[model samples]
Target: MTNQVQIWTVIAGLGIGTLFIRYSFLGLLGNRELPEWFLRHLRYVGVAILPGLIAPLILWPEATGGSPDASRILATIAAITIGVWKRSVVGTVVAGFGVLYAVQYFTG
Candidate 1:
């Protein structure tokens, strides 16, 4: 069992670490214009984040221990296709749900 002092110390340490990270970003780069190379990488942040989000869904459909569902796979495919073909946000969502519902009904 941990003592009160130890628990308070851990909480304090975490709070300090969070503040330091957020402040460092705002302090160092907030004032200056980012370099061209940095900007180029930042432009790809979406490419990185989007796939990171989608990949887990496709690869680990039932990561929480339930049986995997196929509708999600079909929806993702439609979203990617719509995103590629029309490059429209609405189109992507509509196509994705359209695929999901269609797959569900057809499969059911």
Candidate 2:
């Protein structure tokens, strides 16, 4: 396949897969109450996925060509510490980006 065809094929596949995943939950079970155990587990899903999402960016940022950067690492640490101490989402995000920008600016 041509590059454009290949890209469109992948995009269409991902769209269909995402729609199916959403429909499986909302279309089939939207009105029903999920089991207590399931609900409890679901509550932690975001918390679990967040670290997985952030870890790669911190450990091997694309900007650094997949090498670990000190600024990103320190920012992550600051963000985690602020999150634990303040328990504030806004505070955590502010601290993380703030540290990331400040360190990058000063060090470079």
The lDDT leader among the candidates is 2
The TM-score of candidate 1 is 0.70
lDDT of 2 by residue, 1-108 (tens): 479989999999999999999999899999998899999999999989988997898888899999999999999999999999999999999999999999999999
| lDDT of every model, 2 decimals | 0.86, 0.95
Query: lDDT per residue, candidate 1, 1-108, as tens digits?
Result: 999999999999999999999989998879999899999989989988988887877767765355457788779888999999999999999999899889888988
Cα lDDT for residue 43, model 1? 95
lDDT of 2 at 73: 90
Residue ranges of candidate 2 with Cα displaced over 4 Å: 1-20
Q: Model 1 residue 37 lDDT?
A: 96
Quote the RMSD, in angstroms, for model 1.
3.2
Residue 6's lDDT in candidate 2: 91
Report per-prediction Cα RMSD to one decimal. 3.2, 3.1
Q: TM-scores for all candidates? A: 0.70, 0.77
